[model samples]
Target: MIQIANRTISLATEPFVIAEMSGNHNNSLERALEIVDAAAETGAHALKIQTYTAETITIRSDRPEFRIEDEGSLWSGRTLFNLYEEACLPWDWHKAIFDRCAEHGMIGFSTPFDDTAVAHLESLNVPCYKIASFEIVDLPLIRLVARTGKPMIMSTGMADIGEIHQAVQTARSNGCGQIILLKCTSSYPAMPGDSNILTIPHLRELFETEVGISDHTMGTGVSVAAVALGATVIEKHFTLDRAAGGVDSKFSLEPDEFKRLVEDSAQAHASLGRIQYGQLANEKTSKLHRRSLYVVEDVEEGTIASSSNIRSIRPGNGLEPAYWDLIIGRKFAKDVKAGYPLSIDHFF
Candidate 1:
């Protein structure tokens, strides 16, 4: 178990929810602070933003390799440099945004893309650090962030077991002691079927660390399912309104949708009680409403008990239903009214 700003990340507690504000602020400091307030209102535990400049992440090159070419991609025909230039949060706004998060009673953190980005976040004293899926293979960057001795959340999107192992090893060898692995599908507006959240539990077992989902799906169902599979943290892109338009708004959840995700995921976690069977203590009254052997009609003293006179019915103040066969051939020892529950003493 790990604690992020007083919120405990463990199966024994409510899932720690994070509202990812990646590029959803639309370059407006006001909107970014609003996003922070909205996330806090939904009971989310943290607000996560990216800490990188376009210049730091990429160079001003028109090279073919720098352009996004996938026809189905969200940023198709856009160069990585230009896309990030428009999407990157300004370095000057970090303190105000994080301060707004604090005012709303929520912790704030960031995904550091490179060495400079890590150093900048350190100035703000971020409580934790998140490693983006695309950066999972960057062992040097992980080592740098780990040396800060803060908890790290690394998203495993395209990373295979070997790569994940190297990253975790790098972090631990440096100084990080608390780590979480988030199962992720790198696709924007990712499909629910592609989520493969069953891997969440396997991640925990494989790395002996907390596990979660960096959900790119369109609804709360996938996130809720992750909690049932032992996810201790859940991260989802959040925005005030998808209609307002932003780099990631196409796949981001609106405020109300994020609230539902928070509530439903918590309910799913609460429902994961220990394994048990048989009647429960709270069900004692309900058990009395079960079917049992009783006198369906009327019988008199010295009368022969038979199937027509006695049968299984509701209201459990009677001989157990299992005794029906044995009592069928017995003679009544006393008279019984139509509604009287059958008892072994009623027969010879």
Candidate 2:
């Protein structure tokens, strides 16, 4: 189990939900604070930001290859540099954002895209660092982040099992003992079918570390299902409004939606219950509603119990139905009245 900001995060407890405010701030400090407040109100335990400048993430190249060429992508025609520039949160905003999160009692952390970003976040003494899905293959960067000795969370989006093993090995080799692997789908506005949430338990078995989900799907359905499958943490993009035109706004959950994710994820986790079951504590009183043997009509002494006089009915105060055959041919020991609960001694 990994502890973050004094919170014990593991598969045993309910999922720790982190609301990622990545680039959804729209470059405004005020908006960033609002995002933090809104996420906190959603009962999310943590709020995450991305600490990277465009220059740190990529070069200023304008070549056709430097721009996204896929027509289906959200940033289709935009150059990577320009897109990152617009999406990047300024370094100066980190202090206030982190402070506000502390004031609101939420864990504040971020994903470091480069070595410099890691150093910058380290100076702030951030609780943990997250490695974005795109950077999973960047072994050197992962090593640098791991060397900080803080808990590290790596997202597995486009990575195959072999690549993920290499990343996990790199983090462990570089001195990071507390590591969390998140099952992720790289697509923006990912579809439910592509999420493959069932991989959560498998990831835990494969890596022998905490496993979680960094969801991009439309609703809380994916997040809740992930919890049901043993995901210990859930990270989802958050925005004040999806129609506000931020870089990740389209796929991010608004305040209400994120709140639902937090609530429903916890509920799903609680519903897992223990392996053995007869009746839960809350169902004790309701157990009386179950069917059992009872007298349906009046029968005098020496009367043979028959289908007409005895029946399996509700209000389970009578003999168990499992003894139905034995009681059917027996004679009543007393004058049983209609609607009376049958007892074992009533049979002679």
- The lDDT for every candidate, in the order shown, is 0.92, 0.92
For residues 266-329, write the lDDT of model 1, one tens digit per residue: 7898889899898888988896788898898878999898889988888877888888889988
Candidate 2 lDDT tens digits, 117-212: 988999999999999999999999999998989899999999999999999999999999999999999999899999999899999999999999
- Indicate the residue-level lDDT of 58 in model 1: 91
Worst 10 residues of 1 by lDDT: 2-11
**Backbone clash total, candidate 2:** 0
Candidate 1 lDDT score relative to the true structure: 0.92
Error of 2 at 259 (Å): 0.7
What candidate 2 gets wrong by more than 4 Å, as runs, is none
Candidate 2 global TM-score = 0.97
Best by TM-score: 2
